[model samples]
Target: MEFFNSGLRKNITSVHPAYFIIGGFIGIHNVKYYYIFLSLIYILSVLGNTVVMTVIIVDHSLRTPKYIAVFNLAFVDLFGSSALVPKVLDTFLFDHRYISYNNCLSFLFFCFISLAMQSLNLVALSYDRLMAIIYPLHYHVKVTHRFMLFFISFLWLFVITVTLFAVGFLTRLSFCKSVVINSYFCDHGPLYRLACNDVTPNYAIFVFATGLILWTPLVFILASYCRMCYALLKISTSKERLKAFKTCTAHLSLVAIYYLPIIFVYCFGASIHPNTRILSLSLTHVIPPMLNPIIYVLQTQEIKESVKKMLKFRGRTKIATKN
Candidate 1:
């Protein structure tokens, strides 16, 4: 009777595993080449984002609400990639597969938080742009550093709270089943699905998070662009229209690079191969961080001028040192 009672208690209690094996890159042929590509991408992402952040920091002229949003985007990109890439290489490339329960939760928390912030950071930028274009007369008065700071701080608070709740909910689940996570990292969906207990709440969290973090931002950005388009059409001359449109080019490029692949994955994820999907998603995470700074440098006139000024000053410094 004691043995049967023990079994019943064991069945009722949560069986949290000590470690989860990261098998995201398993059963794939010659994936080392892909790992090498990730290594290169990570390196570029770090360098590019660092430069953009540095430029924004040092150039007093770039000190505006718009640049603040740009700075946050760069930081978020660096952060998101830093959270994901190194761990991926450690697990898949170096074969450190077993992640402890606490560490796995921490990992998932960081990743989701960064992703949420990335999407919302774009919304912040769109707000800045909307004010500049739609309300040009009051742009200066309306879009202040104080306002952006408050808005971003609010975003940080909300995203952290929701993500913590999501991660916290994982502790409630009983994972008596397989501990091998099939995704590239400690993904929310795959990790929660492995639970032996009912996972309807986790599924609810997934839906809520996806809609809030992904779709909401995209829809808001689309609306902002539509409004900008309508405002631009009122401009009488083609030259004026072109100049206004130029302002949004870099931002639009960034939105495309960051969001399009995600849109594709969402639309066609079921039809795609798992390995292909993983690669595509990974690219979306790493590639945008690399390209974002490049777009700013190339497309934004202010950033371009700032770079030129800095390079000229460096050249003068070199000449002075030689003398």
Candidate 2:
């Protein structure tokens, strides 16, 4: 409460026309190492997501609702990272920290949309898994391609609409004397914490919007997994249970990694060190996206089989040329 009140007091200062993003470093001996490390992460996240999306598009066998969801997740991860990481790199490495008011709001809008969209995609993936496990015989029938398309469309619409509402109000809030953001990106909390005006309305809408966008999907995922556990219990054969668990392992890992930092950043962030907070925030943005394809898609049997077949075909072509 003291921290929150302190933050509030900090907000009640003179307004700045623009803002500077103070890229919080991890106490590295050389800041270049940090920049290089983040640059590697950004590159890998983009490449990984691109590979996943390309595989989904090119591999006709993977043209299903499941892969479609994977594609969407990859896209969101790519979009989200692209939105934040470049700006972060510029701020830290190139000293382009000063962001105009419009640009700051733009960054806030896209980043929020990315976060919300990814959360919703994970929720959709959970439903996909649940339907597969619980309605195995009717999974395709129950979750058609059209249904998935509609669901994804609605998710974008809902998140964008809510994000626009939140960011629109955020842009109206008056920022004070300190134009420097402590975190790497234009996070809503830090931005609003800089506001000089009464933030009660914005804060209320932010909480409600956050709950709607982030927590709602998380609740759905937990509930789905709980039911999945019950369904697994009903399966008489250990083999079937094992198979179900194996299928879910990746999703569960992703869900855990993605949400834990989010919970920390939102709830217990004040208790954490500033450097650790910055690292956690960066990790939340980078780690899951970088790992999603490796864990969820590339490790799957279908992709392995496709790659094997492609390699075999290439080998045959080489043999034919030699002959």
lDDT of each: 0.87, 0.82
Off by over 4 Å in 1: 1-14
8-71: candidate 2 lDDT, tens digit per residue:
4443435546444554663546868877887898898998888778777878999999878889
Worst lDDT run of 10 residues, candidate 2, spans: 1-10
Best by lDDT: 1
Tens digits of lDDT, candidate 1, 43-130: 9889988988988998999999999999999999899889999999999888897788899999999999988998899999898888
What is the Cα-based lDDT of residue 117 in candidate 1? 93
Clashes of each: 0, 1
lDDT of 2: 0.82
Leading candidate by TM-score: 1
| lDDT at residue 100 of model 2 (Cα atoms) | 68
TM-score of 2: 0.89
